[model samples]
Target: MTDTTQPNTATDARPPAAPRRRRRGGAKTSPDARVAPPPQPGARPPRKPSPVLERLFALYPRLFGARFVPLKLGVYEDLLARHPEDFSPEELKLAMGQHARSTRYLESVAAGHPRHDLDGNAVAPVAPEHVHHAILELHRRRHPRTPADAQAGLNARLVARVARAIEASGLPHHDYAARVRSRDASANAVVDEALITLAAQAAKREALLRAFEASGRGEPEFAEMYGIPLDEVRRSLQQARAARTPAT
Candidate 1:
């Protein structure tokens, strides 16, 4: 009877599991789950040239055509001398163009050619470096004192010369000299003011040195005279004394 009346064990056995939903690309489902990929490293950016640099590039051929090859070469040589580390062939080319323009302008002015004007006067352009050299020469002649004094004097003379050239060439005097005079006056005032400040500093230093010397302490008067801080002076004196003292 037990065998004949057995419960429906076939239906009780777990019904067949539902089929898994497939991905759109029919890829197999990973048992552990998938992770998003990491981002790749960014690429290095390109270096940009300056506007002045671009202008120089444009000017090179124009300058070369004007029979200023020697002048351009000299300019490159000077640039290389001044900035050996930074100077490159491209940079040299730019510098030479600038120099050529400057030299040309100077030559034109000297030869009685018209100064630069908005009007079509065919004014010759000068190189900035050449003008700088000429200005320096003038400054040296006018002021035989310090380099700073010579530079100031030269700058003044340059402005005056530019004004005169403009007038002689029938070009509008751009009041360049007047502007320079104003700037020079301001600079001279600053120099005068700085002299007073420097004198005060010098007096303070002298007084400090004198005090240190009179104290007869281990401190150095030179440090005080040179306006070094008390802590630094003390440290320097200690080191010096230690250096001079014989090792036990």
Candidate 2:
């Protein structure tokens, strides 16, 4: 009865709270919201370790550990099915991509390691083309500082690399040529030169073998007559014999 005659001064002294203003679209703006500036053109994105990669390392230490191995083709499907609860398809795909492009993985491929599955079982051999490309990429990475004037030496190294890969493949000239054709004209030219060098080497070895067989002289005598090192003659003969032997 005492307050009914007059306004409650405590409530009247307090101002009402301000209403939140809405935008043109009726969406309320947040005071703490911020807009990030757009990324600069030609700027590289920052690199950081991915969370999925860490999880992969925890699960498959053998493949994703300090020592990496070449993974079998289509390993993405296996990973997706095996770890459905832990990872999404997109996350796993990106993680696998990062792993494959890593230097250690490329090294394994270049070294001609057999492709391995999740269980570390060798499923199939790495293709010759894959090995060739890996070697080329690794070479570029390792020789990033090579000067333009040293191009001849660089090309020689490239030819050597291609030749080594071709030899390791154990494929005939025509077969390797057919399998390794690509849009890279310079690489193709290098491969052509490497093949020619290999053919020349084979011809020389065959001639040496024929000469040794015709001379009927022992290893030392034949080497002395041809002015070649006995070890070299022996190696050449051994290689020729292996080449002639039909694969069983």
Candidate 3:
């Protein structure tokens, strides 16, 4: 006789399943459950490089073959924007051409390897800043600001420097008078000697201005190197301005 109440053998064969564990702090979550986090505000989407930039990159190596250096296209773009359309293209070409022909740039190209130009002549590469400066030179040349104008500006700076130096040097009249009295020299002799010393100092100051300008050093660097105070530099610049002013 068949037992009607007997459990199925297939159901009894499998072992009991383990209970799911919960997080120690947070609420329990299913393995399949997911929480999508909020998106970041003002997140920029990926940008495609501009066609002009891509073209420039493509032509760069060919233009300055064996000496191409990667640079930001935005810098040239800004320059191109500010420039007059009539000369912009020509200026860019000129700058790039100069870079290609520069011996310094060519040497850098072959820094560690045997790099040669199309005609098999070795060449150097330059930094983007060099090219940028070349572009600036073109603009400056076009503008033609006179050397005297430049000198005038620098001289104003020079006067400021001189004033600061004078302050640091103390009162020249008092100093000279004390020395003259100590030596029992005539007052007229002291005045003459002071005049000669003043003339020499003026020459030295001019020389210093030339040196600083030639070296391309700013005020801070010049002051630090020569032990002159910044205030003195400003004073010298002011004195130069006064000297240059028209007698009105």
Candidate 4:
């Protein structure tokens, strides 16, 4: 005898798995969780403007008048933000002076750039383009376009140094070295004139010293006679003697 038994289908059956939903905002998480990369170490932050820049902003009115400041200050600030960090305050001022002497600026002056309105203000704001041109020109000046430009600058510096050395030479001295070093006009004749002046000064100093010694170091009388400062008489005499002394 055989018995027919119906197996339970519910116990044998499994429901379909629900579809996997993606993450709302980010990538789906993988079975092996990913670790975020660490931030790079030792990254230098952007540099800020030097303190001299602040002073430059303060001096703008004196450097460039209201007429020149036509654009909103923010515009100039934006341009300055692009100003090279390597440029120093002195260099910036130098660039500005160079710009002022430019033929374009001079032509504008001839055309009355400094003209004023009835309200005691500039007729109009200075052309922003003009200012920008000056900025570019200044950068060019700093960079020096041609070989001659750099040489010219060096020559100017050498000439100035020569002039200073000649002026400071208190005794008869031949600065042939300076004449040779100066790339510009030789100041050799200047040395001759300076020597003459020094000789005269020496004569005067010697007379004053003789009078002082004769008067038993009387400061007031010697100073009155020479018409020199009484307070500086001792110092002047000492300096004069030192100048005449040859260096060992």
Candidate 5:
């Protein structure tokens, strides 16, 4: 203390901490600090549609046009398969458009109708008899020797007969312009024949129900196998029973 060494006081203080070490090379930069160019104003992104939506859109035009008849028929078949209830007038119109009336006629013929006679007794329409007879004749000519051939032939004949009768009665060509205009009367003839054939098939089912009842069998175990309703089957069965009973 007595030597008074002028103690390096003011200039030394650790050299200002070496200016924070200058970050080794320079101050660190963040990725966001870099500027990016902006996109052009008019550029648009491509539009895409789902595959299912695209398929439905593609089908719309055909589905709404006259060509939709086959589609409607397919839907009818599906409805008959899944649910045996008859389609309402509005539903038929929506599905068949111009052909609604014809479709309804066919359905009625296939299902048969009940009318009241003079004394207020119910009179049932005879199911497509002519058509059934014609089918039997055809099968007799074609498959004369098959096993259980008579019964099978009878059933086939009945189916065809019903289909033919309905076709003739309904006159489906009245609604189909192409059929009406075709030079081949044979086409219309064939269509009429077909209606009877279908009606006969329905009648054959009724006949089967009768066979079951005559044999003391319970209501047909598989009456609704074709997707027809159990109640409708029962109704047909009742009709068959009444027809067989002969009025007192």
Candidate 6:
């Protein structure tokens, strides 16, 4: 008899496989995922400020702000001690170097301001030699196009700055010269000129003091006799006395 069972010609009885659900987060990414497009040609990427500097700014805005102040000599140690976890020694050193060498910091140093701590408290006076160097460096930065020969001759402004720095130091002329002497003959020549200027000023002040003492005149009388302002005469006398006083 012909079997009633029809040949099972129907397609496989299993239901169609479910479409793969997309990953919850999206398509799977590979290790070689595409990165952001590179910066356009000739277009520079914005530079991010050093992380260490950012941390320092957060901690001591006053010390690291636009109007920077001279930092105490041991500020590096102080920072490390206070924020051991926030900074690595090498990066901290690099940031500090950059900060110290910045034009703003040099300006603060050149202005004869006292060094300050993180708390903004004045800690000590910046050394006169440091001030002198800052002034020179600032001049060099500003006058990059100045001829080396002309620079060697030393400009009037630089000469005056040198004189002021050494005079403010309250050090003997020889001592000051010895401290700042370098192999640069031009710099030495400038220093010599400054010494001469300081010497003349010293002599004038000494003579004025002597005359005032001999005349037994009060500051006002002495100022009148010399046709100088009373404040000027007093300031000159005080400065001379301070110069004579030994540094502790």
Give the runs in model 4 whose Cα sits over 4 Å from its true position: 1-186, 225-227
Q: Which number leads on TM-score? A: 2
Candidate 2 achieves a global lDDT of: 0.86
Query: For candidate 4, which ten residues in a row score worst on lDDT?
Result: 177-186
* Candidate 4 colliding pairs: none
Every candidate's lDDT: 0.46, 0.86, 0.48, 0.49, 0.45, 0.85
Alpha-carbon error at 177 in model 5, in Å?
17
Question: How close is every model to the real structure, measured as TM-score?
Answer: 0.25, 0.72, 0.23, 0.30, 0.23, 0.69
- Encode model 1's per-residue lDDT on 1-248: one tens digit a residue: 46756556877566879998887986976967677555557955544644544553454443333432223224556546655665576766775455544544345434442233222233444433333334434444554667566455334444445434433333222332332233454334433443344445445545654556677765545556667776876654554444345557
Best by lDDT: 2
lDDT for model 1, please.
0.46
Q: Give lDDT: candidate 3, residue 203.
A: 66
Tens-digit lDDT string for candidate 6 (102-152):
888999999899999878999899987788789878987986644555665
Candidate 3 C-alpha lDDT tens digits along 56-146? 4454444344545323324345446654453356656656555544554533432322334333344543333233233333434444556
Which residue segments of model 2 deviate by more than 4 Å?
1-46, 144-154, 220-232, 242-248
**Candidate 4 lDDT by residue in tens digits, 1-248:** 44436544676356768998988988877778877656579866655644554444455543344334232323333434555574454655655455456544444443324333222355554333333233333444545546665444333333333334333433224543333323222233333444555567667777666667777747777788778888789876775677668777
| Candidate 5 per-residue C-alpha lDDT over 1-248 given as tens digits, one digit per residue, 9 for 90 to 100 | 36556545676544655555567766787988756656578966544533332332344433322322123224445444443454443554354443323333233333443332222244454334322333333444554554554333334444444444445544342342233333544334544555555556557767767566666644545454445576777777775565456446
lDDT at 22, model 1: 81
Model 2 has how many clashing residue pairs?
0
Model 2 agreement with the true structure over 60-141: per-residue lDDT tens digits: 9998999888899989999888888999988888888998998999999999999999998999999998998898788778
Q: Which of 3 and 4 is the better model by TM-score?
A: 4
Q: What is the lDDT of residue 166 in candidate 3?
A: 31
Clashes of 5: 21
